[model samples]
Target: MEFRNTLEFAQEMDTKDPLVNYRDEFVFPKVKGKEVIYFTGNSLGLQPKRAKAFVDDIMTDWAELGVEGHFYADKPWWDYHERLIPPLAKVVGAKPGEVTVMNTLSVNLHLLMVSFYTPKSNRFKIICEEKAFPSDQYMLQSQVRFHGFNPEEAIVEVKKRDGEHFWRTKDFLSKINEVGDELALVLIGGVNYYNGQVMDMETITKSAKSVGANVGWDLAHAVGNVELKLHDWNADFAAWCSYKYMNSGPGNASGVFIHEKHLDKKDVPRFEGWWGTKKEERFLMKPHFEPMPNADAWQISNPPVLSMAPYLASLELFEEVGMPALLKKQKSLTSYLEFILNEIDKEVDSSFEIITPKERGCQLSVFLHGQGRALFNYLMEHGVIVDWREPNVIRLAPAPFYCSFEDMYRFGQILREGILHNE
Candidate 1:
């Protein structure tokens, strides 16, 4: 449990690591000539070595079968998305029928909003965290305007009480209670992008549903980073992209979930598309829309086999290790990073601050005292792979699948040498 040095630390943890074989599974990033200690999987995950084979499988089908690839290939395009649903559903804690991989994140958010956000004249207001990811804010703003309402009056943003870095659960719960009658929907980010705080999803979902309001989650940062119970918690719906911790590659397909309870109801207002029709009768293509009876009903287009390929590969890793084990490793690795960062702070009395909450999903946001952009560039150039958010804050995520405790120790040394000593 304890090591006197970084090398000893890494070797010990790696020895006990159940998922260590996963390191060979990925192509870690190289800096100069060496494999840099990669700690930015929260921004973009390291690619799986199997990704090429997965993508090639689809390519091979296309080359050999041509137009018949839809139904004739090993993983036929006609049923490709189905191949991923069981594992995908298990990862997010939902029934297989309740989840479907679909378009990109922002696009799926737009589609879910169309059905979920029905602001009546009296109850037209929505509640959201202030400074949500810009993309989400833009989507909500556009949706409000398109529906002939002003976001100024329709959007209620909750901030940290006075000057706290993250919103406390009580603050959000109180606001929901006070405004519950007038709130039509609550759209929230599962993890705050700037601060790395994991929102209390179950409590938030219960409060929103208690007031008869639809709730949706943007799990862009939460999906693979933390354990979620979507069905047990009764979330109305949710959506997220797969490129980050899921390691599906950049701009890979995203997914959406609608509770099965909503699937059979014919009264819910939603945009209808050919892909949402029942698979057996899809070719018949009747004029009236009878949806496929679950989240699959949310799809508007056929599956893109190329994007789903890498995701299928990633999903296999999740199934093999299972989420509980992954989450356990994540907690230990992340705590190791935080411990070393604190040690550096104590040793140097430096002004660098880690404002990210301790309960965050496998990430810590470091705020530098000097010029942030310059300091961040120095770290990257020195072979410590991490990402910087604007104005300030560097995000370092020591992903459990491949990162070791030594990576954190090395990163801390990089910080102490690069930024702390210079001060």
Candidate 2:
């Protein structure tokens, strides 16, 4: 962890990285004549090279089979959707039928809300984090309105205590306990997008469910970045976009999970769609709505094969590396990042601060004292890619599939130069 300023140092770290070969699998962006450093997997991940071929296979089927592609061709579009189930289920630690690829993130959230957020007279409030992704907040507010309630009165949000930006698990649990009686649903981001905090979903779900609340998660930032056990953890439901850690391309298709226990529960209501009907019975064109069991019941329409292609490409790679080992690599790489940032700031001693929790995921959210945007733009110009949030915080995530120890080294150079030159 010594401070070194050259790509040679980066090369040395890369040589030691057991997961180094993963870099060759992706298409890195180029700025001018150089390879631009991409550290914003917190936002969008780099595309895998195999993604094109995956898409092309689907295209060929569409051309050859025409209408028959639904049940014919190599993958057979009729059962093609199920092909992704095994891989998606494995990524989230669920049984094969417990997960399904479908819809965008917020759309899936609304559908899940229909089934799980059946608010009763006593347990009539929804709980979530403050400053959740805007789309989620919008969906929750609109859903609250749809249910004949004022969001201001029906929603309870957990924000950092005092002036802090992150909450400890103990504090989070205590807050849940305080509102145990009033809660109907607890929907939390698996990892808070702003601060890079990895919420303990298993612990949180257990705490909430014990108190009679439905538990769900939005794993946009956590899906492939962290190891999840939605089924074993007994999470009632969860949804995620495939674009971030999953690297499925911009606005890629999403996936959802429902514990097997809910498959035949007549009590659970859902927003009905023809696509969700039993496959054999779906083509009958019957008036009755018979749902396919498990998370597949959440599907609203025919699967978008084009979008599913990249997700397939990404999921296959995740299957190869395995999530547990990938996480171990993440901890080491991010720990190195944290250590280097602290070391550089130690010399300046009193100016910059990294506000993210010490045990955060791949992203490190830094809070600049006064100079934030200026420093961020400077880093971009120097080809040290990262992201900036409103007012001050900057997020940098070194994705496991493509990011390298070398990325951290390069950013260190950018950070040192930006801070010193500004001073």
Candidate 3:
């Protein structure tokens, strides 16, 4: 597929796009009375137009049914979160019984660690990627400290080699081997937030398991963006936020994946709550904590139906267009974006270094050599919504659901003009 930096070529690609119509499903923000080219789905997805209807239903049900809404609403609030499991399971590549919606990403991670991160006198070190998301880093540090160990000693970071933008699989595996008997758990971001590099989860999971270490993933940037096989990979647990690619509202509820092998185990340590008990026996209010037979066992409270409503709305779109179709378009769309970047770089004699490797999803984190924050401000003012990292990098994530080929082409034009004007 030859990509051209022309309006006609972009429009031709858009015409042939099977997912092009989905752009209308979302409500994009306007800049200067025109829809901006959105490239921040990795940060916060655009609000789905259907989200309003979903929320309205919940609001109406609450107004009419009051306390009875838990049992009497059209979609019973008591079981509302279950509606999200089927589609959410498919997104994360897990069985329906293996996934559940719960608290936010970091909160779920902390709760899951209670079950997976069991430290001993000799085996207490945890392996994670260097420069993980700040939330993850803080969580790991606090968890280690709570267990009476210094973070510098208990947490093993797999640092990228000098002069490299991304981590290598071999280095991670080697680090796991070096830790050997001391490795208690392996938890890293499935897709790095900074470089947009998709880690080799299957291989790394295998290696970590071989060393008698529990494994998990922080899929904040990976879920709904890349292909995942959490069940097949035998990951003990994983957690992700819904706001990014999942298109739930800001700081919305999160999703979790717990392997079937660990389900229904009475001995597994977890924070217990009434909602996590067996459904039939929950109302009985028995004193004993009999866990749910699936991933819902980890849930610590009743479902937040209001937060889950928008998520359910977004999953409807996922169900309409399966992940397979979304992934197929993602590859082509991202490649076209890369081609446009290279073409613009050559045309302007500018150094636009794409740090995101080939093993990536929709995001392309480019280092604008000799460019500054002024260029990012210029692009934003010109109706290009991209993310600016510290120093001189900008992350452009062209979400397949709403972003179009013409958005990429137009971004290239804006980028060229910004460069020229800055000079």
Q: Which candidate comes out best when scored by lDDT?
A: 3
For model 1, the local distance difference test gives 0.86
Descending-TM-score candidate ranking? 3, 1, 2
Q: What is the lDDT, from 0 to 100, of the residue 288 in candidate 1?
A: 81
Lowest-scoring 10 consecutive residues by lDDT in candidate 3? 1-10
Task: Estimate, for each residue in 1-423, the C-alpha lDDT of model 3 and write its tens digit.
Answer: 777889999999999999999999999999999999999999999999999999999999999999899999999998899999999999999999999999999999999999999899899999999989999999999999999999999999999889999999999999999999999999999999999999999999999999999999999999999999999999999999999999999999999999999998899999999999999898898999999999999988999999999999999999999999999999999999999999999999999999999999999999999999999999999999999999899999999999999999999999999999999
Local accuracy by lDDT, each model: 0.86, 0.84, 0.95
**Against the correct fold, how does model 1 do in TM-score?**
0.97
Off by over 4 Å in 1: 1-5
Worst 10 residues of 2 by lDDT: 1-10
| Cα misplacement distance, residue 234 of candidate 1 (Å) | 0.9
Model 1 scores worst on lDDT over the 10 consecutive residues at 1-10
Better of 1 and 2 by lDDT: 1
Task: Please give the clash total of every predicted structure, in order.
Answer: 0, 1, 0
Q: lDDT tens digits, residues 1-423, model 2?
A: 464546786688779878899889999888777787888987888999999998898899888879887778777776667878888888888998889989899989898999889877777788889888899899989988888888998888888888787877777688789888888899989999999888988888999988999999999998888778999999989999999989999988889998898985545688778888888898999998888866777787989888888888888898888888789888878877877787667766635667778657788888878676888888888887789888877888988778777788777777888887887
